[model samples]
Target: MMTKYKINCLIVFISILFLHSGQKPCFAQKDGDDIVIGKYSIIHSSILDEDRLLYIHLPRDYEDTQLSYPVLYLLYVDIYNYFADATITTEKLGGTGEIPPVIIIGVANTNRYRDLLPAKIRGRNEGGGADNFLRFFEEELIPHIDKFYRTKNFRMLVGPQAGAVFSLYALITKPELFNAVLSENPFMNPENADFLYPRAEQFFKNKESLKNFLYIKCERNERPQNLEFAEKLSKLLESEKPEGFRFKAEFKEPSGYFIPPIPFGEGLRMLFAEHKLPENFHTNSVKDVISYYEALSEEYAFEVDAPSHMLTFEGDKLSQQGKTKEAIELFEFQLSLYPKSLNALMRLGEIYRRMGELQKARQYYKTFLTIRDTDVAMIHNRLNMVERMISSSAACRIEQEIRKNGIQAGLRKYQMMRSDPNNELYFDESEFNAMGYRLMGAGKTDDAIEIFKLNVKLYPESANVYDSLAEAYMNSGDTENAIINYRKSLELNPDNNNAKEMLKKLKKK
Candidate 1:
């Protein structure tokens, strides 16, 4: 029989085991039914001279979408899972247009005190590996992540407690590594606080501008020492901040030693405040929204497109308001930005059909078919109705001409018809390019040249058109004209690699 003290210790041990087992695993299990939050990977860090595990949570559509996402690197994930939960929730909100999608990378620690502390104390053995740890992230982990993931240049760092102190150290020491920093109740006692405060002040003194977001929050009922340090640091940053450095500090009622999700969510909202679209935006012109995001892209230093669902909703609202022309234009503009949007194509087709434009409706519906394979029955029925309408209308003559003559002659006839006040025949630049390529493939070099020339006339500023014309001229042995057009193409877009190469070859000849 065991003694009473031994029995009590056994019970405590069993309880601890039960609690730990109840927590979520950091990696996916082999069972097929369980949902995987993230995967586990290892990095061999030469700076730290150790192998470290990385817990990575990618966006849900990461596997399917070609889009890149900003990264959020969180520290001390092994001790607290709340940060991961907060990151995942915030990312979901971002998907709903509250912010921008972000990839979460959780760094598991080998030695918490040694890796987090900035320097060694007089009698401490395990408290001065912070520089090596930061070097590990900078030299090894970041490059590995970038190579394996579709990541944008924007990055954020987040931490709590001692990890938070490390975060601030990285921010002050290597400001260029991350675009944002979130530190929750950083461990700032007198010694480290004195060391860090001056460094931050000196950093700001030298820099003219710092385009980064920094948020530091502390608990209201925290230890007096920690709270005092937070206040001092916050005041220093507020007083000596450089231009373009977005900084915020907050003191909340005590939650726990670990950061609660509420403050984390608030920090994320504050950091990406510009990413959200205005709630009261109401416009019939899509250009207004596009221009708003274009300006925001310049501010954020990343290209951002208007959300597709927002565009669709606004277009539908415009259509319901009897602004069909504006709705059509909005949908067309959406297609121009995102050609893969089947919703825009379908909406345009329906709007044209409602306006009794059978030919235009048929064109959009056919494009929808080309992009997607679903809705076969509805598309075929609509196409048949459009064909019936076209067969009984005067547009039948243009279809007969296209069938009787070649594409070039048909295009010429269409142009002639369009010149008449009664006819509305239309041809786009893509149609001309396609026909030109087809003619070029069939040894009709002169016809191809004329088609490309017509395209250049239609779109004078298009470097692609001039480049195609130059290529046609080269094929036809007209080096002088080819050189002229190639030079024009280079002037329009100096980065046109094909034109540069062809020009070099032609000049060599």
Candidate 2:
């Protein structure tokens, strides 16, 4: 019991335990998994002339994978390590049959109030640093990410709370940042809400390529102002006839992490939901909206793509107009007729997953995965489910062992780097995305928005950014602005039914 070998081993074990315990546990713990957290700094803001420190999360497979991966950059609080634990935890929890495995970039705030505010300010609460912050994101942060990681052009952004407000500003002021945006619990000042809608119309008045996704959520715990603001945002987005914007919105009670799954997932589903794909949806919002557009095409003696250019004046025309069952049937029929259609297969898979038919969802998702050559942002999440469902003890053991060693070894290095204050941490995009979502949960909206906008600029070809920006705008009560961005988004992808619906509502108001 007192041998030197045993004593040495005991000391090492105790040291590891102590170090791990001291590390923050922001996320919930799985049975045998660990989250790697670290911090880094860069000169991101030119106006402020200050170094900004950011937190990063590395996923379980980050070190294991050599293939280039897509990135999701998340904005967070102003502090160097604020919400660091929460960010890691949220991503871990969301990975379980919820969202995707993403790199999280948590930007710590040196001056959140200054950087996130869209207009000039005199008081501490008011901010005017938005433009400079935007510039920093577009020029420095994004380029840094591209250079430092094995990243494809595909990217997404995320923000929450006041960060959602800042995100809206970025969406309207500069629409060419990221391909997709995910925003949670935005703050919509009444004055700001009024300013949003008209600005939206102006932004999208000129036709532009707008392939983006905007996913927004409003928690019910806040004042009536929040809900009312969300409604206004919905109206504004619904009015515009954008081509590529996919907008999905919902109001729900706040959950602890990364927004609640019910509404947030629903929004995600709507924004990216696929239709039957052999006749793939176009970027012009013409072929992908709904049957109404198809019927209108014939009645107006217009081309099938006519709706791509036409302004949808009456978005509510479909209210109580179609049966859910019939809608499902049509989607299924399209898939049956066009087996190679990406949109159809994705929709079918999502529908099956939602209906708790994991097997059917797996089949469609597998098919989609084979054809999906671009970013598989949510692939890891799906893979986790597949692995769990396979029921192969050998396979399970192998994966478990790999994960254990991976997480534990990563944790060890992570602690060493964190302890060394002089050292910096490196991260890819998936880690950044998880960080962004965690920042949202902690009510750091401004930083999150900046992160997301940068993503849009980096990946202009993606429609997901527009969708994410629209959600951020809605949270901020900048419905007018949300609508304009949504229109711009629709311009990129005409098939997004969610954006079309939101645009119709905005027009009605």
Candidate 3:
């Protein structure tokens, strides 16, 4: 039995092998295209106040078409070319209705710690340089790209780890700089929350209009702090609901970690298709796309291939190029070809849902459930009243129980609940509050605060409530409030480790 970790590593290795082999000529093998892949230099005055070197890989078809494609800007702090193969693969497949094509711009760092850090601080190597570095992008680099290339108005940015910190800053400060951004595995900690939350709040309040797609994929090995930060950022993005602001968060538990690159790659391709030149470069009829996918499935049935996801990958790119109808057709075709494919079915349903075809979406979801009865918890939740009405009374009762007691419990509890409709059910808020404590135990003070707030609202009299909230607040730099809450919590319980520590910390502050 191949474990999930082994599969993830195998995929990563194969992807690297694929890139170096270059059997696929989607990367810059052609000439006379401004979307070239090479190093360029710019004077960095604003953030670093020094000269900066960067690399960019332009799309293959960029030169031939007068239209401009959105650029995916990346900061290669430590890792390099993680997505180069997938980027090219997506673009090549997109050209032939397999994925979307977009320019890849890689920004190399002479002093990554300095350029990507949000603050001007000491202790780190060549610290206190981010301001000058960002200045370089605004004053010199972006201007250079616009002048040199026939680019689209849209842009995207990708960063991992330290670079992800910078990406978060860009999202908040320069909200309009990129139409989409990806921040993977940011090394979040105590310091990040102190900075990020205030900035996020300010960003949401000030930047009233933000039409961008933000994708955050936290690795399974990612620090708990980073995971907390990602969760917080995701919730904030969802809550704001800015115009055209779309967001996705993939937890990618150890078993699912390797799957993130697929979505990340797919997202870029989709954004590329949205801004691709001539728009109709990869458009096709529904019949044609269905046939193509059917053939693909036949070719890769025995292998652990991503054939089902491939069509969605293609649809994303097409959608990017303003061929939404074609994109929808392809998604629908993918479902028709592999009615049981979870990825294909979900994508089809999503397309319909986005288009406001709720009935059609529900039908696809129903079909999907018929194929795979397990792991349909979220899909079942998304169904509208009409679609839910089709379920048998017993099924409806089960679903209601599931909604009330979560899918797992509902699975087992359904038998008992079915036998006695009058059985009393109570959701233990203390257990829910304990979940927040567990997060805090893992050093996720910021995320724990969110959970604590909910816990307090639900169980205001719980002695643990004030302690957790005060500790979380103190950790996040709200000293005055921490003091207030510490007193309140201590009033409830004279003995509490959290409240005592928090009070001591606040008093020192």
Each model's lDDT comes to 0.75, 0.53, 0.60
RMSD of each: 19.0, 29.3, 26.9
**How do all models score by TM-score?**
0.62, 0.43, 0.45
**Which residue segments of model 2 deviate by more than 4 Å?**
1-35, 42-44, 78-100, 121-125, 205-209, 254-509
Ranking by TM-score: 1, 3, 2
Candidate 1's error at 53, in angstroms? 1.9
Q: lDDT per residue, candidate 3, 57-98, as tens digits?
A: 555545433445556677772244444543556455544533
**Candidate 1 segments exceeding 4 Å error:** 1-32, 121-124, 256-259, 325-509
Write one digit per residue (lDDT tens) for candidate 2, span 1-509.
11111112344345435545744443445665532343454545554687776555554445544434345666664322224433444343333312333455656666665777565443446666777888888888878777876665555666665566677677777666765677766655554555555675677555454666677787777557656776667676776647766776777656664433223345434532331122333322213455544663343222222111111211112212423234345455444434454555665565555443456777888887775634555654764564454443222222233235743343354345446677534322333333334334445555445444544654566566666667566666778877977887899999988889988987787
Which regions of candidate 3 are displaced past 4 Å? 1-47, 86-90, 96-100, 120-128, 205-208, 255-263, 269-509
Cα RMSD for candidate 3?
A: 26.9
**Distance from true position, residue 386, model 2, in Å?**
29
Ten-residue segment with the worst summed lDDT in candidate 1? 1-10
Q: What is the lDDT of residue 381 in candidate 3?
A: 69
How far residue 157's Cα lies from its native spot in candidate 2, in Å, is 2.2
Residue lDDT tens for model 1, 1-509: 11111112344345434534744453433554423456777777778888887778776556645778888898887654644454456545665666677788888888887998786644666567788888887888899889999898888888887888888889888988888899888876656677677887788778778998899888987668778878988888777888999999999887765445435677888886766667777876777778888998888777766665567877888888878778998898777655767779889988876555567999998998886655357777887867775664333443345447865675676567657797654445655665566567567778778878877877898998899889889999999999999999999999999999999999999
In order of lDDT, best first, we have: 1, 3, 2
Best by lDDT: 1
